[model samples]
Each structure stands twice: as C-alpha cells, then as structure tokens.
Target: METPVRSARRESAPLRSTLVAIGLTIFGLLGAAIATLPAVLVDPMLAKGVAAASIEGQTLYMILNFVGMALAGAIYLAATGRGWSYVDFRLPSTTGWIYVLVGMGASIAFLFVVNIVVQLLSLPAAESEVVAIVGQDQTMILIMIGIVVFFNAPAEEFLFRNVVQKRLYEAFTRMQSVLLASTIFALVHFPMYVALADSIAATLTSLAIMFGGAIIFGTLYVKTRNLVVPIAAHAALNAFQFGVLYLAIEYNVEGVGTSPSAIVGILPSLPP
Candidate 1:
C-alpha cells in the first residue's frame, strides 16, 4: 500500500500538469497575437517604399506571420517541459502512410465543395485587405506556394494539432478537442479577412469555411495519432489553393466587371 504522502503526490501530479498546460495555452495564444503585429501593424510602413505589386512584400508578410506562430509553439513546448513528444513528430508506422492520402483527399473534396458553394451564392467576391494591400507578382507565386506548403502549413500543424489539440485531448473528448481547437484556429485567422469583411454575415461565412477545414485537419490528426498526417494534408490543401490562384492569374479567370482580386475572392478560396 502507498504511504499517505506518496499517494497525495501521485494525485497531485495530474493537477500540476493541468495547471502547466493551461498557462502554456494562454501564453501561446498571446504570443501568436504578438507575432502577427509585424504584418498586422508594421508592414504598412515597408509597403510604402516598395511598388504596390511587389511579390517580395507579400512573401515577407507571410514569412513573418508563420515565424511568429511557429515561435509561439516552440515557446510553449519549452515552458511546459515537453519536447518533440508534445509535437509527436516521430516517424510514423508503415500503416500511417494511408493517413497522408486521407488528409489530401479530404482536402481536395473540401475545396471542391467550397468552390461550388462560393459560385452558387453570389457572395462578396473581393480579396481581403491583406492580398489587395500587399502584392503578388506572377514570378513569385510558385515561391509563395513552396513556402506555404513546407513552412506555413507545418508551422500551423505544430501549433494547432500538436500543441493545442494535444493538450486539450487530456481534458476533453477527441471530438471536443477537435472542434475547440478548430474554432480557435478559425478565429485566429480572422485578421487576414477582417478588413475585407463588409458585414457580419460575410465575416461569419469566411470563419465558418475555415472552421470546417480545421475540423477536417484536426480529425485527420486524431485518426493517425501523428502530427505528420495533418501536416502533410495541410500542405496539400495549401498547394491546391496556390495552384488555383496561379492558374487564375495565368488564365485571367475573372468574371466580367470583376477585378483580379474579386475573381480570387469569388473562386475556390484564398489562403487564410
């Protein structure tokens, strides 16, 4: 039988872990907000010097956004006394390969459905302030896609699937954790669309679309019990988004009377 003191300590361990997890989650959220400040607040200063259509500026904005969130994830791991295990990034088993296909296929289907929905409903089809304000030269679009697929997507997976959902799983059902994390994920991204939101309904529509995608990604993570599954799938989603955008630019797939930004806004979807 355990001693009284020993039994007390055993029970206390979970409480300690819960406390630490909660604190770290809050820190991660604040850190993410801080990280966005550069692009959200400071980038306007730099944009003035560069040409309105400079690809370099848009790339820089994305890089800064990703680095901030990724950095927050790293900080959360360090503060919580967790390591790669927090991220669960180990080489998955042979069977785990199936999940990769699962994520990509689901993402493709979601995008197709989303694209159809956008067309069916004549919604506000104007690009967000971020895209309209910065610039995207055709030469750098592929580069943008490469960064998004490799860095941006993985960084988000680490932050959301690995850190946020992983911690929440200990306190909630798998589905609960997925929906909660996905909701936060969607909300955090609102800054990207906030300026372009003409009304509450339009904003809600964008948020709902993103939340749905996050659910798919989160579900994939839960299914495989591996971060790589969601990461790969997220990258595939981003790849498709970029490919669509590039194709639009190349083919000038704009509705009559619509600006390039308007076409991008109305079609498939823009990166969020």
Candidate 2:
C-alpha cells in the first residue's frame, strides 16, 4: 500500500508541474493583454473625439498595467498554493538606506558611463518617443517618470523578481529559472515600439540590455532573497533615466541625442 501511494504521488508531480506552467503562461498572456487594453481601446476612442485622449490613454495604460500584473501575481500564488508569507520581504543585512544609496550611485554612474559610450559609438537611444513627449509637455513627462520610476519599477520588481522568479526557482534550477524569467521580462516589452527595420533593431538592442539588467537584478534577489534591494536598484536606474531626460529637454540639447556619450557629458558640443 505504501509503495503504491508513493508511486501515485511521484506520478502526480509531473502533472502538477505541467498545470502550474500552464497557469503561469495563461496568466502572463492575460495580464499582458489586459495591461495593453487601454492603449488598444482608448487610443481609437480618443481618436474619435475624447477629451484629453492622449493623457487618458497614458493614465489608463499605467493603471491597467499595474492592476493586470497584480491580478496575475495573485492567481499565480493561489494556483501554486503558496501563501502570501512565501513572498519574502527580507532586506539585506547591509541596511536599507545604504542599499538605496549604493544602488542609486551605482545606477547613475553606470548610466553616465553607458550614455558616454553610446554617444561615442553613435548608438541610438532606447526611446526617441520619450524625448518628443518630454519636449511637448514637461508635466506629462514628470507624470510618466513618476509612474515608471517609482510605481511601475517597483511593481515589476515585485511581480517578476519576487513572484515569478521565486516560484520558478523552486521548481527548476536557479540559472534556468533566472534565464526564463528574464526572457519573459524582455519579451513583455516587445510591442511597445514600431516594427520597422530601425525600430526593430532598436527594440532588440534594448531587450538585450534589459535582459542583461534583469539577470543582474534577479541574481541580486536570489542572493539576498529580498525584494527591497532589486526594487531599490530598479527604481534608481529608472529615476536616473528620467533625470537625464529632464536635463536633455531643459537644455534643448540637440545632436547630443540618446547615445550614451551624449548623456554622460563626453561630447563637448552637446548641451549640459
């Protein structure tokens, strides 16, 4: 009887794994669709004559993305029978404020360096639309940065690093799980830009950068087993980006472009 029961349990493990994978995949797709629904639905409606359609679309997109990711995370936790307690909030022993400061410094320095390199190499910036948006309306730009740097970045860290990566790490090898989650993270941003040759090239390049960053962030989470470090780091990086944009717009920096060099103050002719 014992042997039979053990055999039955062993047989069920694979089935359970399959079900979990299916659940996660479905949840992810559903989440993505729901998150983008505002852009899909509102953009057209606004085209017809909605007041502040652009702002409405942007606001809705941010809201839906947050809500969709949260819902998906909840579903994932439920399906896996993992209690909320499993979501670790432990910070590193080094101290929270120290981590925040270090993260901020490191992220800003890295951005500064990368911006210099990109500018020297004449590489395109990740999102040109962001520049145009900032140029048109500074208030909107600030709102966008608030959403992305603080809210969206933290939410993403929670969902991807904490929830998805944590679950997958339990079920699979650490490296495999990290790679998988990072791939998913990069892929999620696929349709944010146009699909033309230049756009596609830029998108792919940005994904590669994001994937590399995700790996580092994911590894940090695994090592610390804490969400706070990665969250801080992610937010820091985003805030740095926003600051760079603000400076660029304020200075009417032209020809300085999105290249790393332009951002890092390497190009003498570029605006400070």
Candidate 3:
C-alpha cells in the first residue's frame, strides 16, 4: 500500500509542476498589463494639453510605468515564496562582462538583419505608441534617452527575464522556457503597434522582430545566470538607439528613416 501511494504521487508530480508554471505565467502577464494602465490613462490628458506633451510629462509617464512594473514583480515574488533570492543580481565577473559585450553586439547585429528583412519583405515600418507622443513633442526624445537606460531596460528585464523566464524553467526545457517567455514579451507589446503599423502584416513583422530580440536577451540571462548581463545589454541597446534618433533629429537628417517610428521596431524593450 505504501509503494502504491508513493508511485501515485510520483506520477502526478510532472502534471502538478506544469499547472503551477502555467498559473504563474498567467499571473506575470496580467501583472505586466496592469502595470501599464497608469501610463495609458495619462495619455488622454497629454493629448488634451491638460498635461503638456513635454519632457516632464513623458518622464512622469515612464516613471509611473516603471514603478508599477517593479511593484508588480515584487508582489509576484513574494506571493511565490521566492522573494529576491530567486534572482541573481550580483555584479558580473570578468567573463560575465565579456558576455555583456557579446549580448550588446549580437543585439545590434540582430537589428541590422531585421532592418534588411523588413526592407526585403516590403513591409511598411511599424511605429510604437511612444512615437506618436514624440511626434507631438520633440522634447520627449530628450527624456527618452535619459530614462531608457536607467528605467526602461531594467524594468522589462527584471520582470520578463528574472520573473517570467526564470519561473518557466522549472517545468520546461531551457529553450522552451526562453521561447515561451519571449512570446509573452512580444504579445504584451502587440496592442501598442497594432494601430500604428501600416498594415497587419507590418504589425506582425514588428512583433516577430520583438520576439527575436527578447530571445537574445533571454538567452544571455540563461547563459550568464546573472540578470545584470541582460539588463546591461538591454540598457546599452536602448541608449544607442535613442541616441541615434536624437542625433538625426538634431542634424535634420532626412530620407534615411532615422525617426522613432522607423527604428522602433528594430529593437525590443522600448518603453511602453
């Protein structure tokens, strides 16, 4: 009787683990969505000029979004009994730095491929929700560069990589976990691009690019076992991208598609 009972528990373990993983994944996704609500709510005021569409307003918006996500992630951790111990935030060693550099380079290289593929497919460029705000107030670009590194990058990686991807590892293979997490990352951004994209095809392509970029970030986190690697890499990429947009706008460069809308789809993890 004891042997039969033990075998029955063993048979149910995998199923139980899988269900738990699925439940947690849904919770993480919902948390991310809810986290964006405050920022989304402010958009109406910005448009009406009740809050000026300036750098200050945009910065507040970003801060709200970042803070919301961070709080949600903290709650998720606490609920799971993992808390902060589950995440690896120690400073990267020399080898970890090498991986950081590799991640940045690989992400950039990946962008180049994405740009070419977009052109080859003749798909129209996809714009993000942020691009609309930038179009209204150019000063928003200034704020973007300031916060993207310190806020946007860390917020996304901490939630998606550290919380979501790490949680998935318990029930899935390394590759499967990465892919699933990346897919969720991409899906969460879909609403931002849907109306802004030139066509459904363009929107889908943009999400695909986002998914791929997330995969790169996820892989870096998995390989290094350090969240900082992905966070740093994500920060550097956003900084480089927004920097280029600022330069192009300042120099009045044209016909090169350097605007926020043109390049936003090339990378993932931009502000929501």
Candidate 4:
C-alpha cells in the first residue's frame, strides 16, 4: 500500500540521482578548467617565468588541475551533506590487488590491440597536445611520468569513479553505472582531441579508445568497491607507457610516432 506521496518520491529518486550525476560530471570538467586558471593567468605574471607549455609549466597545470577537481568534489560532497566518508576509501584486499594487476594488464593489452586495429583500418588516432612538447625530451617525459602517477591518475579516478560513477549507482544498475560513467569520462575528454585529431574519424577513434580505458577503470572500481584499485591501475598503466616513451626517445626507436599519446590518453591528458 504505497501512498501517493511515497510513490512520487520513489519516482523522483532516480531522476534526482540522474541530475546529480550529470551535474557532477559537468563539474568534473569545469573544475579542471577553472582550477588550472592560475597556470593560464597568474602563473605567467609571477617571477617563476614558467611558460605554460614547458615541463614545469605543464606540471604546475596538472597540480592545479587536481586542486581544482578536489575543490569541486569537496563542494559537491558538502552540498549533498555527504563527506569523504561517502566514498569507499578502504585499502584493497589481496584479491583487490589481483584485480588491480589484472586491470593494468587488460588495459595495456587493449591499447595494443587498438593500435593494430587502427593501423589495419588506416584510421588516424590523435595524440594529446602535450605529446608535441614532451615528444623526445627524456627529461620532460620523465617529469610527465611523475605527474601522471601522482596527480593525473588520482584526480581522474576521484572525479569519475569515486564521484560520478558512485552517484549513478543510486539510479542505475551497477554495470549501467559503469557504462554511463565511462561515457561521461569519454565525453569530458572529447574536446581535448578536437583541434588536434585531424579528422572526425581520428577524434572518434581517440574517444573510443579512451572510452574503453574508462570502462576498464570503471569496471575495476565496481568490481573491487575500492578507489585504490582503479587509481593504481591507471597510474601504473600511464607510468609504463611513459616509461616506454622514455626508452623510445633514448634509443631513437622508429615507428614510435605520436601514437603513444593516443594509447595513454586514457590519462585523458589535459589540453595544452
């Protein structure tokens, strides 16, 4: 015997959860954009003289991006009367650690397969703008490796997995939540490739690859119910890719074109 008021509330719950998820997704992107403003504006005026594209400049940008996302996440939690307690912050169990390793292996294997498919089809996969600056500079690549490990991976996992995906769980099935969150993750990253992707095909290919990476990340988060798993997998995959980049640059390996950016753009590397 459901009362009318109770029925209305039940009907609205999913809608409310949906709207909240959308809002948080937008905020995740907006936070990164807004948080990096200091790098875009004030940092240039300071005595540091860090060019926005230099390794130091990019590192600063990433750090500020994380700060912005953290602020945005905090604001959301506060508005909802939720807090850090709302997220599953527990350490991974031994089983969770196994999932983490599996996630990394799966993601790497996915990227390798994607490269082969793209080449077979002759589709151009766009690289991140950062690729140009960090291309062959072992020093810069090393710095970026550190940035991805510490700042980039955690910030993205915090926003997409801990925040966005978690919110959607209230309204959707767990797999649906993972899927929707992965889509949002890909969409948020779509703009970074538009100007540089060369064509719609290339841009879409890049987005699809990133979408797959997010799926891997989201699936693992749902599977383990722990943020640390996805964060570790994401950070490890990026670190490995960058490490490879370092070796390629150091050894002058051929055929290592800008594609590595596409492979690791799951970091969804921020725009320049």
Candidate 5:
C-alpha cells in the first residue's frame, strides 16, 4: 500500500473532491464577474477594452478573482475536511526558498525562450494591456506588485497546482495531470488577451506563453509537493518583470538622446 504522501503524489482524486474543486473554480469566476460589476453597470461597460485597462479596475479584478475566491476556496476545502496543509500547501521553509529561487531562474529562462518564439512567429509579445493600465504611476506600480506578488501569484498556484493538479492526479498519471491542468490554466487567461491583442493569432500566442508558464509552475509543485515553491517563483517572476518595466518607463535608460540626469541615475552618484 502507498503511504499518504506517496498516494498523494500518485493517486487519482475522488469524484466528489474533483467536483468540489471544479465548483470552487466556478465561484472564482463569479468573483471575476463581481469585480467588474462597477464597469458592467456603467455606460462604458467594463468587459475588457475600457475598464479592464484602468489601474483601479485591474486591482479590483485581481482582488476579487485572486484574493476573494482564494478565501472562499480555503473555507470550502476546510469544510470538506481538506485544509490547505492537507493538500501539501504550507508556508515556505529555508529549503523551500531555495526551490523558489531555482524555480524563478527556470521560469525566467522559460519565458525568455517563449518570448523569442512568439516574436519569431510574428505574434504579440507584450501584454500591453497590463502596461497601459499600469502606465508610469508609482502608486499603480506598488498596487500591481501587491496584486502580482501577494494575490495573483499565490492564488493561481493554489488554484491550478494545489487544487486542479492535485485532484487531476487522482485519476491521471502525474505528467498527464500537470499537462491537463496547465492547459486549463492557460485557457483561463484567454479572455485577458482577447481584448488587448491586435489579432486572434496574437491572443493565441499569449496563451502559449501562459501554457508554458503553467507547465513550469505545475512541475515545480509536483516535484517539491510544496505550494510555496511555485507561488514564490510566480511572484518573483512578476516582480522582476514589473521592476524592469518601472526602470524602463521611468528612467528610459536606452532611449535615443538620453538625458544627462537619466545617465547620471545609471552611473555612480559619487560622494557629495
């Protein structure tokens, strides 16, 4: 007989548990709907193109979809006698941090390669919608950090890896479960791209990137059996991307005819 951990790592989830997870994901969808209520009720209609691109709107959307649903899922799972830790979800440890660092490194490489492929394919490479919403505002940047790091990252890992992948593994092999869950994860992001992409091909290409990211995060979860590993990795990647964007937009480090102050910012300030 397999030990609990061994079975967890290998077994197919029960039908009832799987159903519950699917339902919880639905509730997460509802949260997304509610998040956009403000835009929905207004004359402008916040479905995607307009409200979805505002900093305030995006924050609400992320909070509802990530944080709101995350809490509900936790409660529901606990009621069903499967607390997060029961699913191998817990805070990171010293070793866990190491895995997160490694995961981040691998994720960066993965995204870099994916971006290259996307550009080569003549597909949209930037999530410009996100950048447009964030703009050059410092406050918006900080809020984005919170959303990406504290809410969106962990929330996604919790849902796709801890819940979806875990339950899927109950019936499928580990690899199959990861692949399936990653595909679903990628698909969920489809709507986000649809409004912003210039063409369907661009949206599809963005989905491909999401698919790749999902696979990377899912693999980390399976290998370590720790949610924090993937969460930190996801958060770290978001942080790095946003941080780079900040430096680029704020300082314009590489723009033509760069200003003296901008150049000075890059160089040593030297003692007064």
Candidate 6:
C-alpha cells in the first residue's frame, strides 16, 4: 500500500511540473506582447514631432517588457508557493569568476578569429553597417551602450536565465531546459533587420551558438544558485561586443565580417 501510494505521487509530479511550465510560458509571452504594444501603436505617430521619440519609444518598450515579465514571474511563483528566495543575487564565487573570465576570453578570441576568416573569405563587411548605425550621434551611441549593458543585460538575464531557465529546469532535464531557453532567447532577436533569406534559419544558427554560451552561463548559475554570476557574465559579454564595435569604428578597422555561423570555425574540432 505504501509503495503504490509513493509511485502514484512520483508519476504525477512530472505532469504537474509540465502544467506549471506551460502556464508560465503562456503568461510570459502574453506579457511581452502587451509590453510592446505602446511602441507598436504610439511611436510612429509621434515620430515626426519628436526627434528622440524613437529612442524613448524603444526604452519604454523595454521597461514595460521587463516589468511585465517580472510581474508574471511573481504571479507564477506566488501561485505555486515557491519560495521568493529563488531570485538569488549573490556575486559569483571565486570559481565562478574564473569561469566568467575564461568564457569572456574564449568569446573575444572566437570573434577575432572569425573576423579574420570572414575577411579572407570575402563575405560582406559589417563595419559600414556599424558606422551607418552609430556614426551619426556619438552621444546617442553612448546612451545606447549604457542602456544595453546596464539595464538591458540585467533585465534579460533576470527574465531568461534567472526566471525562465529556473522554471524550465524544474520541469525538464538540464539539457532540455538549456536548449529551449536559448532557443527562445535567440527567437526574440529575429525581428532585427538582417539580409538572411530565412530569418528562422539564421535564428536557429544564432540560437545554437547562444545555446553553447548559455550552457556555460547556466552551469555557473546551477553550481552557485546565484544570479550574480550569470549577470556579470552577461554584462561582460555585452560590453565586449560593444567594445569591439567601438574599437572597430575608432580604429577604422574593416574586414569581411563574421556572422554567428563563424563560431563553427572558431571552436576547435572535437575528437570523433
């Protein structure tokens, strides 16, 4: 009788977890869509009168999106009676810092190597595009960097790595959670302007690279159960990318640019 009862409870656990995950996913998506509604509706209307309206609109959209996600997370956690202490913000441990540094170094090295290969291959250069985007207003670029590195990175990590990843991990295995969360992260970036014929294909490729990166970050978070490690790592990575762009412009460096696909070339071949 005891053994049968325990088996029944164990079998039902996964089903309950899956239901929770599905609910969270739906809430998150809905919240995100609602958050962007102002930008979708109001930004264009005020575009002509206010030169800075576009930037303001983008900022508002980001703020709302983060707030919405946070609210949704709060609701889910409250409903489940999961302890609120799950939002661990402790700084990464010494070993975590080591991982962060190593990860950052590897990412920068990959970018450099890929740029060289891309130049040699004569692929399209991103320098011109970068310049066109950032050259017009130096102040705007600085502000944008501040927003992205400081505000955006932390918010994104909180949403994807902290909240979504944790919830997904509870429902699925480590590998499944990592892949799914990374895929969602990459999918969110697909609307950005790009020349790729199939945005979905490009997104999947980006997600794969991001998935690898996310795994490293995810592992650090799981080991320490701290948000700080992933947050620092996330911010550092964003800063590095910004630094690369700033240097590329400042030094007038030009080369055929590497897309995320170049990660394949940059990473060392694994043993068969």
Query: Which candidate gets the maximum lDDT versus the true structure?
Result: 4
lDDT of 1 by residue, 34-89 (tens): 65456534456443532342465555655665666678889777876987557778
Off by over 4 Å in 3: 1-44, 47-52, 136-138, 255-272
Compared to the true structure, candidate 6 yields what TM-score? 0.68
**What digit string (tens of lDDT, one per residue) describes model 2 on residues 166-210?**
767655677777787878776654554333116566566656655
Per-residue error at 12 for model 6, in Å? Answer: 6.3
lDDT of 4 at 180: 85
Task: State model 4's lDDT.
Answer: 0.77
Q: What's the TM-score of each model vs. the native?
A: 0.75, 0.72, 0.82, 0.89, 0.74, 0.68
For TM-score, candidate 5 versus 6, the one ahead is 5
Compute the lDDT of residue 3 as modeled in candidate 1.
Answer: 100
lDDT of candidate 5? 0.63
**Order of the predicted models by TM-score, top scorer first:** 4, 3, 1, 5, 2, 6
Q: Stretches of candidate 5 above 4 Å error?
A: 1-23, 35-61, 253-272
Candidates' RMSD to native? 6.0, 7.2, 4.1, 2.9, 9.7, 7.3
Best prediction by TM-score: 4
- Candidate ordering by lDDT (highest first): 4, 3, 1, 5, 2, 6
Expressed as tens digits, the lDDT of each residue in 1-272 for candidate 5 is: 76999877544455554565566666665654555456444423346443344556556654655665566556656777877566676787887788888889988787566655654765553244555555567677677677778877877777678877887776777878788877766666566566556678767776677777778888888888898899889888877766666677677755312111111100000001
For all candidates, the clash counts are 0, 7, 0, 1, 4, 0
Report how far residue 32 has shifted in candidate 5, in Å. Answer: 3.7
Worst window of 10 by summed lDDT in candidate 4? 43-52
Would you list the clashing residue pairs of candidate 1?
none
Pairs that collide in candidate 6 are: none
Candidate 1, residue 91: how far the Cα is off, in Å: 3.2
